[model samples]
Target: MDPAVLREDMVDGLESATKDVLQDEAVAVAMRDVPRHEFFDDERLAYADREHEVLGTRVLSPRTVARVLQALALEDDDSVLIVGAGVGYTAAVVAELVGATNVHAVDISRPIVIEARQNLERAGYDGVLVDCRDGAQGFPEYAPFDRILLEAAAVEPPRAVLEQLSADGRLVFPRGSQRQRLEAISATGDRTRFEAVSFAPLLVDGEQSGTLERNRMAREDREHAVRRAESRRGWEQDWIEWEHSVSSR
Candidate 1:
């Protein structure tokens, strides 16, 4: 089936599954415009009402994305900050609701950030800015955003990121580690809680623990190789000296 058709069908399923998710025409339109298939390799699952892992992060189901976007109540002129942008699908949807220029997406994974930038561009959202950074800190340069969406689970809202919101901004995120609740916070600190959902922990600045351990091991291997080379050179020197002495005798 054509991707556009599949996308429309997916939105339809989302609207049907969730009570009033696609009531907003903007969100409905955006969901239709952004081709979900461009974000993932599996075209079959692209429009399915299921989640897939992309770049080590979850590409949330259309139902969840619709629910979050609907809860956000985005405006065309609103500036959006999307944390944990996985392959840029959600960002593209937001860009469609708002103008592409009004969206700034940040992800801690550099490779994922690069992939998202490429995906957005490929999907014709060239104006969206996808950056590799600590999403927990938010994009300070683009502070005062009209809305902020966290695609990962956090134990609590990061004050730094929350501070970046505009006076009337709204922020949505899944809270807790083992068990999570989707919490929506208003600029004035009013909060609304939704149903439980599981999401990966939010990543922060600094080398990832796994990457750090791998780097340490690589450094140790290099050091061991250098020591072995030096030892071999010492042995070679000894052999040369003995040969010279023997020849002289």
Candidate 2:
């Protein structure tokens, strides 16, 4: 069982007229070359065309990856950012198309980010930057990406992500909360919609896995909350204090 041949067969099924999920030759080659097994404990499942759970994130299946890359229509040397870099497989494939250094990815879950980084490194795409951050915010430090892909679904494109796109850049995402569809939007606001798809909702601060604290809070804020909770004036406030309610009445 050669992994290379498995990759070839896997992609072949995707390209066959019956499924026809793959059309972009570049993406097909990249999928063939990137060692997808590096991201999985069982190499057999790596080429099975099914989703795997990695650190609470669902890795994109190959057909989904193909559909995304086709929508992106990437060109060489194009800078790309991937939100929700689960296991880093998609980012690695993208690295093949546009060089590893040109790829950047961010994830809201720190554990997932770490997993993605490790997987990318093992897959020899160490040049790709994987960071822990809110996906909706995007990797703005590398602002103005030539292309952006949000693997998670959202009701609409996050405004901050849109802001990070280069004027000529385009973003691909699954839109909607319950009924998601693939969509691409240009920086100038032009949009294109494609086939229906399903993806987990994008997570925000405080909602990320393993977090129990409120979002956007400083250490000072947490300390203040603790102090307030321990103090008396009852440690809790009503919608209207008794005195204030009487005065207003």
Candidate 3:
């Protein structure tokens, strides 16, 4: 079967399953147009079931990708930034959805970046700008982005990324621990506010250990304090009940 046909089938399935979640016509078309198998390693192609992480890079599930693209609400005039773009599949899809000239995709891995560029070129997505850079920092050279999509998860929203977004621009990423919800962050004068939805966690490197440690300690402390407070409250309630019973007798 042609990869294009497979892609269209996937899109159709996704649209059917998530009609409310993804209503954008352009996003559906983009999903149909991009051949996802081209982005994966030859070995991984056999398992073309759904999107999964490969080589530390995630090929986002069609449903998830379609949902996020709908959330972005891309416009033909919009300039988009994709962080942690693995092999440019999502970038290619975004470029097709939002015009290739307006898309820029960046990743921290040099090899992956090179592969992405080649894949885009081969797929006739010449308009996309693929580069290697710190996914955490974002691509500032193309500042004032109308939309920013982080392919990976971050401990906290990066200041650099927030700075790159144009006013009213929307950024979608995973936030929170344990329950890492997909958050849509919009830039408002000097600050960014977000709303939580479900999304897959992104992988990133650097200072992760310290951040994890801090979060663990904070969680432990909160649990300890809650336990102690509950213990005290229970003891107080018991004493009150005993005093009332004795006085009544």
lDDT of each: 0.78, 0.83, 0.67
- Can you write out model 1's per-residue Cα lDDT over 97-215, one digit (the tens) per residue? 88999999988778788899988888899899988887778899988999999988887778888999999999999988779989999999999998777777775543331221111
Q: What is the TM-score of each candidate against the true structure?
A: 0.80, 0.84, 0.72
Task: Identify the superior model by TM-score, candidate 1 or candidate 3.
Answer: 1
Among the numbered candidates, top lDDT falls to 2
Give the better candidate number (1 or 2) by TM-score. 2
Could you arrange the candidates by TM-score from highest to lowest? Answer: 2, 1, 3
Off by over 4 Å in 1: 17-21, 207-249
Model 1 is weakest, by summed lDDT over 10 consecutive residues, at 240-249
- Candidate 3: the clashing residue pairs are 153-202
1 or 2, greater by lDDT: 2
Candidates in order: C-alpha RMSD to true structure = 11.9, 8.4, 13.9
Off by over 4 Å in 2: 209-249
Q: Residue 197's C-alpha lDDT in candidate 3?
A: 44
lDDT of 3 by residue, 197-216 (tens): 44334433221211222222
> In TM-score terms, which candidate is top?
2
lDDT of 2 by residue, 145-180 (tens): 999999888877778889999989999999887798
Please give the lDDT score for candidate 1.
Answer: 0.78
